[model samples]
Target chain A: MSTKTTRTQDILDRTPSSIALYRLLVPFVIVGLWELLSRWIGPRVLPGPVHTFSALYEGIQSGWVIPNTNVTMQAVVISFLIATVIGGVTGLILGFNKPAYDIVEPFFLSFYSVPKITMYPIFLFIFGVGLNTKVGFATFSSFFPMLIITMGAVRSIDDVYINVGKSLQVSRYQMFRHIVLPYILVQLVVALRLTFNSAFLAVILVELFAARSGLGLVLQHAMGTFNSEEILIVVTVLAVIAFVINIIFYGAQQLLEERWNMTSDEQMGI
Target chain B: MSLTGLSSLPYSKQIRLGRATLLVAILATLELVGRAEWFDQLTYVPLSTMVETAYGLLVSGELTDDIITTIGLVFVSFVSATLVALVIGWFLWRHDKVKQVLDPYLIVLYAMPIFVFYPMFIIVFGLNVFPIVLIAFAMSVTIIIISTANGLAKVPDVLIDVGRSMGLSRREQFRHVIFPAAVPYIFTGLKLGFVYAFIGVIASEFILSNSGLGYQISWYYQQFQTADMYAVLLIVITLAVVVNLGLIRIEDRLHRRT
Candidate 1:
């Protein structure tokens, strides 16, 4: 669940254990360079880590951080949930019917590849309010990735299981429960990781564009005042939040995979 | 589509027809809704009107500079990011210890909100094209690096051995064996890199820049030219879909090769 291990486990774990020392040391090196750079650029424009952290602490103590962060988090969470449910169900249903999947697959791919930024304005007109646009953009952005991943996973369920279920004349519910659901259950968490990341970033993006109150507003205020330390503080806070969310989902994915005795490699027919 | 739908056509043609029909259905509904005055004149824009607005802008040569700027930035950012990523990727591939140290950081970098530094970029580089390019490059480069490293790593051991057995030098082995073997993976990276770079450039323009395709769209919306906004939005959407479909075509070709 640590940041280091949140990447594909095999790739992250393949390095020699001794390399772990470098992993631990790299952050220090980056911080050192950052400090020097900040000094060169002038601390007012680019604050050092020490100053950033101190400002973060002060910002927290001043109590503005909580309300703003709360607003962003609420929007992100709601959008994430909405996207997951609708996208997952749609993916599952379409994924099961090959004909439907083939027709829709191109649509999904187009949606996934098209940057939602271009579509944001249209939504802005349709929704008309900043908050509606924010949540709508986040949800809309997250939906395709969730659907695509879920659909792909569903489509990859081994034919053997379905064949056996067919032979046994299992009910659709039973077949889904004993076969299709099991495979996707593990992948669902993995898909959620992507969806959550997308949702969080999308929310932040809209907040940056037009939000009454959010961490992005905090960031905008800092930029307005040329408060470099506060900008760093908010950036750091966001990074930590994103990092922690990734780790949590990753841990859940690992746990689910172990319980299912199925890694993505197996699901992928690799 | 079901067998009942477009059953007379070949399968691929049937799919195309089905998609066309679906698209027409959706667009027709929108056109009807727009004509019905459903969302007030200020909000909804019909499809035909959007096309007319786009034609008007094109004929008048309006948005020409903005279109050029957006396209130029996308091209520059993608190419630069690709070049930088390939070099870094090679360095990482050759240096196991360095790769180990950078792997997690790479993931973090790819996922982190690079826009957090957008404020600094603007202040440091000023409100020029440089900041936008830098942000787009940052947005795209990490995925390319990771993909390049992955490709190089996946180069089959047998291929390398074959190169060595043929008395090829280390450099020759990389050039002939590793690079060719890694083309598919690298191409995959480039594809994703381009997508990210395009998005990053447009998104940055939308958020800050005073001029560009993204800016024009937002400007139209803000000025209450809802039809003009949709028209420009139509342009952006069409560009996106065309480029994406083109990439997917090439990607499919690459996959077929591999």
Candidate 2:
């Protein structure tokens, strides 16, 4: 009580180590509280952080991570590719064709607003509860953003660039390769990053709904059996994977943008 | 003047007509194909069948109840998440150190499949609306926080100086200068946060719970009632469109007022 510190003074006095200490302090408090609560409630009702972490480690050691993670990754990657390709081409067509865009743009806007997972049952019925359905779900869920972003990118390319191509009397293919492709590539990369996240979530959702194997399946089984430790472990692993993938995409996007000498702010009129 | 009228009025009319025609064309084609049995049972269902099933569900009041449940969850979660985000965002703006340390983690939170935390939330809150609300809140709060902080930061130093020169206190300056300046960004955050909350609740209902439109979807799909499932899906899409359009109108009004 005698050694009271002012808020401004405390803030000004914070060094790097103190800042780090403060950062750790929140989680430490949270975990401490969790552990205490868990003890009071017992492990069956609520496992402590230590129990959950150890179980996660044991899960990794027991070869539970590989097959399920591989399945998820496969679905995510493949669906991302499909969404990008289809969405990109469709975006190009709509971006160029004003009439076509007018006809379809409103529908796409509505579709984008809706939770796309509602369409999953349709995909499930069509593709069955297999790789096809999962991939289809991932593709459907992820593609709209890609489509919208790509169309924006295409439409936003300065008229000057196309004028130069026209002045040189270049073929359509040549104009696209020389002018449009480079201009839109950076935007495509941004779209890819977003699509990856959506596709990954879609895979998890589909797996949770109906799947024989995957991280979503793991979570589903755990929740069903009331295996909180297993559920926590799988959830942690999925979060880490998502984090790592996002970092990689962010780094690559930055590098690509730098090489292209374009900032997203300048390009993203949309 | 005629050209202007044509471009402003008839042009928009033409576009709307074209959109309607395209929709009708697609629906008619699907109806034809469905009736003809040109595709497999899983692949095609007639528009008439879907409409009939939707009407049946509506008449029975089952669809209305489910819609109310889902929308109720979404609204509660969205509002709470926005409130929490505003408080945290204001605090973060007050403390630079915490903001800097937590920046990357917030990005991680937004990027990841936060629904994975649903199980843990379920354990904490038990198997009811609480877990679903928590799931929506977790998914959306980060987005609102980032946007709110960005908005607050965007309040110009010159504006604050002006407020001070006008003999305004700190709180008065914030209220008059900073808060108004940040309204656009805050609005954006609220809009996006609501979307995330909607998606989170629906997805959670699909996976975790048993009494919303999402649950109906899962239940119908499981029971092989494809037409009813499609009807529910259609209702959801319509709701999204209507809600979004309503929000757009409100946003426009807000912009005009500001």
Candidate 3:
């Protein structure tokens, strides 16, 4: 078995470079396909990748992209932070309190599916413009998943460790720091990837509905003017930004798992 | 420990009662606030009033049209997305090199705010149900594809070996062994897919649409008919919660089975 494993590892080690080549080639192939399809589909409706990239370049050079992206990202980040902190605490409480978890979890699960965008008007009325509404809306969008996972993380911690800590007369703080924190932190990172997506989606959505400024507004204008290239540019930039954030969160989760010596929630089937 | 003997009830019964009581308390608080007019009429409509308005709307067949239209759009897009995604995902699982190449793109699509392209969809497909369907499809298909692909990847090699030793064909192997094993994961994807689809479609309507439940709510809001809007939202939310609960139940059942 060891000999077979070593042989397989050797084969795996040799293949990554080739896989990297394919990964790099993917965007080029996609761009090429887009360009070809544009010719047949008509440039007005579906501009080539070259044109879209140039427009994106112009937007960046002229200062439209940066400020808009800043405004949108500010809302997303602020909401995400608020959701994470509050949701984590709430989830910990719920996890340790079974009656509360049982009662609240169903509502959380049900609310997860509701198109929260429908309630934007209520936020608009309550906050009356500025940052709070977007942040609140985004927090609402992202909070449930974080809370759910955190609760599960707390619940899933092995009883053996807790019992050992108690038997050792470890202080509550020490018990948390030594056992609960590491396990929960890893799971928190995993949940953040999801919550981040939700937060960003909510922020952009509100911007789309009615915003004084943001990338969503830019996309809306492009739509209003029927400028396909501009629309594609904003979308591509947004996708790239989201992808970067997602990759960062994923990397962070992996680092935490390795460095903290934590078991990932998935391996426990939670 | 209770003098009234209340604590003698089963633990499960206590939980159910607690859940029901909590739910009622929340609704009752909202109802009380609405009646006392402590909150602005613009923000809080009495739950009773909202229900009454909804009944009137249904009697006039106004809400029925919008509900049917929105649900129809969701069903159509969700079904197409599921079929196409399953095909593409199954093909990718069969082709390792292609899956490797496409994996990052799928991740990006899944993470990105696909709803931002709702306008582009509208432009391409025209301002109609087509755009709505396409937006929902775009929102859902990537996650399904990714989940389906991951599920197939996790199908135990031992199961395949069992099927092979039985002289099962490739199709039979997939049908009897691989598909069943991967079902729980696929259900997870489907639950999220349905969620994204519902969000995408309704949100698209909220942004721009002439017909649908979302349109009705937005229209009322725009017209300053806050009570009417609240009523419609109440109906939509109830429908959403009930349907999603059903999906969650099914998902739990599947998880247990697997």
Candidate 4:
């Protein structure tokens, strides 16, 4: 059995580079196919890879990447911060008090599915066509997921932790700080990751609907002029930003998990 | 101790009372604020006015037409996306090599705001319902694929072994054990798919379409018809609430079976 396992391990070690190559092969094949299709259908219908890259390169050189990206990120960061503080506090209150949760949970759940963009007009009407409406909408869109997750995280804490705190005669603040906060910290980070994604999406959405600046507005303009390659560039830039956010949050989540000595899934009771 | 003792009271009745009270309080506060003109006239609309406007629109069958269009887009896109996602998810699950190679891209796609592809979609499908439906499909299909494939991956080898040891054939093992295990995850995917599909459709309407609830809201806002905008929003909120509640019910039933 030991010899058999060693043989398999040796084979696995030998194949790591091959696996990496195989991974690259998939994207290579996909791009090749896309390029072929674009050629066949004509660039008017679907721009080839070369055209997409050129547009993306031009977008960067012309400073299109910097300003629009900054606008979207500003909205995301501002809204994320506001939503986190508000949603976190609200969640803590509701989670700590079952009566409050019971009173409010139905409303939260019901409105959870309400697409935030549907309320953009009301926001636009009130705040006008600029950053305030965009940020407000972004905050509103991202708020509920964080609220729900934080509440769930708090509620899912094993009751034994609270009982231990009570038996040790810790003050309520001390109990919450040492026990409850530590327990829910990982989930809170996870919630921030989710909120970040939603916030950016919301920001882009508002920009698409009624913004003078941002990537979404650029995409809208591109669409208006039938600039498919430029549109693709904008989409690619947004995807890269999202990927960076994911990496940053994931790293933070890992750090928090290590410090807190708990995984989010375990805290979630999954 | 007192709190624990109070918990023994009829839980359902207590919960219902709490919800009702909270709803009433919220509505009353909004009405009061609107009546007192707390905010500027341009900023706030009372719930009564919103309802009245909604009723007017309903009687005229305008909002209903938009609702029907939105629902049709959602329904078609959702069904088609689910089918495609299931096939792709199954294929990915079957091919471990492809799964490993593609997982990171899928994760990026999941986080990426695929709605930004509207321009590209419009380029491809033109100015019609197809772009809206495709946007929704693009948003949802990735989620379905991930959930379904992840579910398949998570089926315990021990359970599979049990099936095999019971003299079950490969196909039978998959049918009885693996498929049942994955059903819950598939439902989760479906629920998320519905949400993204709903958002995508509404958002597309706002950006591109001339009809649908989203367009009505935009149109009314453009016209400076605040009451009409709020009325359309009320209908949207109602639809959201009903769909959410319905999904929850279906989820609960599925979870019970598992």
Residue B241, candidate 4: alpha-carbon lDDT: 84
If you assessed candidate 3 against the hidden native complex, which CAPRI class would it receive?
medium
Residue A8 lDDT in candidate 1:
41
* TM-score of chain B, candidates 1 onward in order: 0.93, 0.85, 0.94, 0.90
Task: Order the numbered candidates by DockQ, best leading.
Answer: 3, 4, 2, 1
For model 4, what is the error of residue A209's alpha carbon versus the real structure, in angstroms, after optimal superposition?
1.3
Better of 2 and 3 by lDDT: 3
TM-score of each: 0.92, 0.84, 0.92, 0.88
What is the C-alpha local distance difference test score of candidate 3?
0.83
lDDT of 3 by residue, B113-170 (tens): 8887787777777898988999999988988887788788878788889999999998
**Cα RMSD, each candidate:** 3.4, 6.2, 3.4, 4.5
User: Residue A134 in model 4: shift from native, Å?
Assistant: 1.7
In order of listing, the candidates' clash counts read: 0, 0, 0, 0
Of the candidates shown, which would achieve the greatest DockQ relative to the real structure?
Answer: 3
Task: Note the residue pairs that clash in candidate 1.
Answer: none
Q: Give me the runs in candidate 4 sitting further than 4 Å from their true place.
A: A1-34, A170-178, A251-262, A265-270, B1-8, B39-43, B156-162
DockQ of each: 0.46, 0.47, 0.55, 0.52
Better of 2 and 4 by lDDT: 4
TM-score of 1: 0.92
Q: How displaced is residue B102 in candidate 1, in Å?
A: 3.0
Off by over 4 Å in 2: A1-42, A164-186, A254-261, A265-270, B1-14, B39-44, B156-165, B249-258
Worst 10 residues of 4 chain B by lDDT: B1-10
TM-score of 2: 0.84
